[model samples]
Target: MESMLIEKSIQGDVASFEQLIVKYNRYVYNIAFRMMGNEEDAKDMSQEALIKAFKAIGQFKREANFSTWLYRITINVCKDEMRKRKEHVLSYDVENQDEGSMKENIKDESTNPILIYEQLELKETIETALNKLSEDSKAVVVLKDLLGYSYEEIGTILDIPVGTVRSRLNRSRSALKSILQVQLAEQ
Candidate 1:
């Protein structure tokens, strides 16, 4: 089914391309939001990625799943935007704003609101720590840890070696621990 969409899209069928965008827009936006750390930038990056994908659809070799291809494009769009901004773009406040939804799974009435607050604080701190990482390290952390991609898949998505992905993940994790430890000490 995806292959059909890709084929039709590559053949310059605007409707087919639009359908592909509709299918993947949210997925792309999510990745963008995580990478950019804000909704507005994520939306912008998602649209840019879709435009790039539409233009470059003919060059897609069918060697990867369409979603994977979209991911690569989205990642590149994020990295490019990051380069242009030359600053940390993640907005920890977004997480705080979504707390109501995040707490929906905590059905236990006995759960402490104070504990939840602490957890949210910790989560925001960790997100801030993530922003401290270099873009490459951040990307590895997002893909491997946040998005649950395997080391090999992360390497494929980022066009790096598996060893590189492992090293980046390790370094990023170590950095995160150090940052969190410092934050905890300050509290």
Candidate 2:
């Protein structure tokens, strides 16, 4: 099926191209969402990536994974969108931030008012610190620590060397640790 689509798309078959988009829309959107931390930006970046993919279908080489290539485009699109909106207004844009934070997720719900209240402020602080990271670092951090992407796959998707992917992940982890340490010390 993939071979047929590749051949037909290379032959200028728009329907085949559309089929490819349908086949991979979820994947592109997932990558976008993880990188952008929101549904609206994810949807927009995913659509733009699909359009760019269609326009450049002729140049797509089959040796590498097509999904990975599309993932690269979607991530890049998310990064570009983030760059345009460099201000830290995501705190107010709940739709753009991840639904709640780690502390929120771990809040006890079994009628433990004390426990729930204790974690609420900490959760807000952690979420704000995460929002302060650069888009590139955030992408690497989420992909490796949250989504568990290997260095090779991340490098492939980001069009960078594996060493760079590893470096980025290390740097992101260190930055997050420092941010958390400071927050914890203040508490």
The positional error of residue 181 in candidate 2, measured at the CA in angstroms, is 5.6
Error of 1 at 137 (Å): 0.8
- The C-alpha TM-scores of every prediction are 0.78, 0.69
The lDDT of each candidate is 0.75, 0.71
Per-prediction tally of clashes: 2, 0
Q: Could you tell me how far off, in angstroms, the CA of residue 6 lies in candidate 2 after the best superposition?
A: 1.9
lDDT at position 51, candidate 2: 86
Cα lDDT of model 1 by residue, 9-98, tens digit: 999998989987786788788888777777888899998999899999999888877777888999999989888877535433322234
Task: Find the candidate with the highest lDDT and give its number.
Answer: 1
Model 2, residue 144: distance off in Å is: 2.4
Candidate 2 residue-wise lDDT at 111 = 46
How does model 2 fare in lDDT? 0.71
Cα displacement (Å) at residue 109, model 2: 25
| Candidate with maximal TM-score | 1
